[model samples]
Target chain A: MSAIEVSGLRKAYGGVTAVDGVDLDVAAGEVFALLGPNGAGKSTTVEVLEGHRKRDSGEVRVLGRDPGKPSGDWRARIGVVLQATSDAAELTVREAVAHFAGYYPNPRDADAVIDLVGLTEKAGARAGKLSGGQRRRLDVALGIVGRPELLFLDEPTTGFDPEARRQFWRLIRLLADEGTTILLTTHYLDEAEALADRVAVIARGRIVAEGTPSTLGGRATAEATVRWRGADGPQVRRTPDPQRLIVELARHEELAELTVSRPTLEDVYLDLIGERA
Target chain B: MSTMAVGAARGRLELREFFRRKDAVVFTFALPAFLLVLLGSVFSGTVLGDMSMSQLFTASMVGAGIISTSFITLGVGVAGDREDGTLKRLRGTPMPVAAYFLGKLALVAVASVAEVALLLAVGIGLYGVELPADPARWLTFAWVFGLGVVSCALLGIAASAAAKSARSAPAVMNLPYIGLQFISGVFINPIVVLPSAMVAVASFFPLKWIAQGMRSVFLPDEAAVLEMAGTWEHGMTALVLGAWCVVGLGLCLVTFRWTDE
Candidate 1:
């Protein structure tokens, strides 16, 4: 069964529509990413699913329960890592994690969750004293301490350094491997490609495209560009069948500095969002 | 775990967080005692034949101190929690809403007790203000303290929803508090000294009744002659404070929001 199912989900703040008739389905144990620009309804949609928001109209079944009428048991089954949280500054990481564990019927060990987030060394330190990346890890530690079956990560690595981002990706992969279904929202195309099994591009409160990263917006079947150093000068050609063009050129003449490239996830993502590269 | 169990755990964490912040501890606990000392020293004269001005201020200030710990501390704390994403994170978890409120009640109860103790110590040690020797007066103190803390704490939580952010919470909470202290006779001795209109206005608020209840406990029966109605009016005190408890709870139910949205 799908972990999440939404159809015709519509929400508006005052006269401004934040999410307009968006539909989504996330199967159990799958990593789904919603990619969008700022104010593109990514967070709004995720908040609705997390039961932190009330939708104007739609049907949403998260883990087979309506999120709008959330219960403690329903909340216990899902974990959420919100964007830009700076709470729990006074408590040490260990205390904060342990305190949250008591809220759920089944919880992961506090120490183990701390180690999983690579914050074991700083477990005794106050959350307020941690750097930005370390604080984010603490947020993640609190998020997963309950051993939730489904996790929602909203732009989890927004301000991380490259190394920190890579470590966070590995942790996400580890969780995904452990059979935890995850719903992620991000502006980073590389992050979506690295972590999401399937990605959906949201633009102006609607899903513009949805598929596996390689095939999203037809990236897998899109035309390729071939380039080489010709006798006249540099040469470039765009073609759906790049192999045939490469063979034709190789048989007729010597191709110097030859290269062939297809669209990257970022390229397709940018095109889907109507942004120029 | 049961919701009450989780609430108890939350209470422990809330206490840890509250004591860890040195500024909050000092400001919330020490400010009232400090003000009492400064004011009591300045006004050493007697209001009645045996009742000194410092003694009158001491009794009234105790009531103010309780409000400080409950109303101001809670207003600022709740607003800070909202601004810093603490409420949002708690809402996202399996923690029940009742559990969160129970935690706040625990924090306010503990802190107000400590604050009252500090003010009483300062009142007795420095100002020569006497504690009630009669068991009946002690009973009055008990009920007054209980009702005052509940009513003020509820109003504090309700006021937090009106504050735009934590940065503005102190101003939002303190304006009414300081204003009430003056008109309620905490700063001025002899409840009759204030303008009759101002006294009437203060009579409508919990602070005036709370101070009157405290005075009834600490002051001699003869001092009742100086009260607004020329009596302790114990029945009136209970009625006003009890009514405030209901009104404050109604306001809290109407105004409270987990987030600004």
Candidate 2:
């Protein structure tokens, strides 16, 4: 069975509709990324799936059961790492992890989970004293200490430096290797490319596109830009067949500083969201 | 683990966090005792025959201490939890809602006991307030303390939902709490001293009954004449406190929210 299945999901706050008639499916053990700008309903959609918010109307199943009626046993199967949480600031990293572990019937070792998040050196330190990245790591540690089969990570790496972001991606890869299904929501396109097997772009309360990271919004098959220094000046051409165009250009004259490039994930993402003119 | 066991664990963690906060320890645990000392010393004269104002303030302060720990402390603490993402994080976990409340209750129970002990010590050692000699008075103290803490705690949880954020919680909780102290005769002694209108207002709340019950335990039986009715109204106290418990529980059920959303 799929890890998550939703169709015709709708939710609104009074007059403003946050998520409108959304549909989504995430297969078991697959890493799915939902990409959207702020206020585009990514967090709202994830909150509904996490059973934290009630949907206005929807048919949704997570782990083959409706998340709307959550039970302790059902909750045990899913882990949720929320956005920008500063909870448990008074507890040490080890204490917080151990405390959350008790909630699950089958929990990962607290120390092991802490180590997985690379917080071993700060295990004895209070959560309030940690830097921003370290605090986020502790949040992840608490989320996975239960050894959930399905994990929901909402913008998990929002404020990380470059090195910390790389480390977080590695930790996520390790979890995915263990066959844990992960539904991640992030606006960073490169993060989606680095970790997710499939990606969905949501804009204004609706998903505009969904596909693999390489093929999202037809990224792989879209026309490539070919650029070269010609006799006149620097020349650029858009072509569906870049190799053929490059060969034809070479037959006439030596192409100086020649390059053929496909659209980046960011470029396609911006285009899909109608942010690029 | 059973839900109760998990609740106990949550309680242990809650206590650990509560004590680690230096400001919370000083303010919540020690402020009431300090107030008892300050107020008990300021008032020198006796209201009734041989019952010094210090003794009356000391006995009544015990009930106020219980309410401070259970109501103000919990109202602010729960609002802080909501603001700081504690509630949202717990909602994501497998922790049962009952267990979460059990943990808060446990914190209140321990804190209230310690608060009462500190207040009593101050009352006995510093002020010349005497402990009750009869076992029956201790029984009254026990039931009054328990019912007062529970009703106040439930009301505090319900009140927390009204606070916009943790920063505003103190103002939201303290306005009514400090006001009630005067009308309820915790800050003011001899219930007859307050206006009849204010006494009627205090009668609707658990604080007045709790203070009157504590007075019944600590003061001499003849001192009941100082009360508004000129007698210790134990049956009325029990009925009022019991009714507040039901009302407080209903408010909690209706108003409590895990998140502001």
Residue-wise C-alpha lDDT for candidate 1, range B157-233, written one tens digit per residue: 99999899999998999999999999998988888988999999999999999999999999899999879999999
Off by over 4 Å in 1: A251-257
Taken over the whole model, the C-alpha lDDT of each candidate is: 0.92, 0.92
| TM-score of predicted structure 1 | 0.97
- lDDT (10s digit) by residue, model 2, range A190-223: 9999999999999889999999999999989999
Task: Compute the TM-score of each model's chain A versus the native chain A and list the values.
Answer: 0.97, 0.98
After superposition, the stretches of candidate 2 with alpha carbons farther than 4 Å from their true spots are A251-254, B47-49
TM-score of chain A, predicted model 2, versus the true chain A, to 2 decimals = 0.98
Residue-wise C-alpha lDDT for candidate 1, range A59-177, written one tens digit per residue: 99999999999999999999999888778899999999999999988999999999999999999999999999899989988889999999999999998999999999999999999
lDDT score of residue B174 within candidate 2: 85
Candidate 1's DockQ: 0.84
What TM-score would each prediction reach against the true structure?
0.97, 0.97
The DockQ of predicted model 2 stands at 0.81
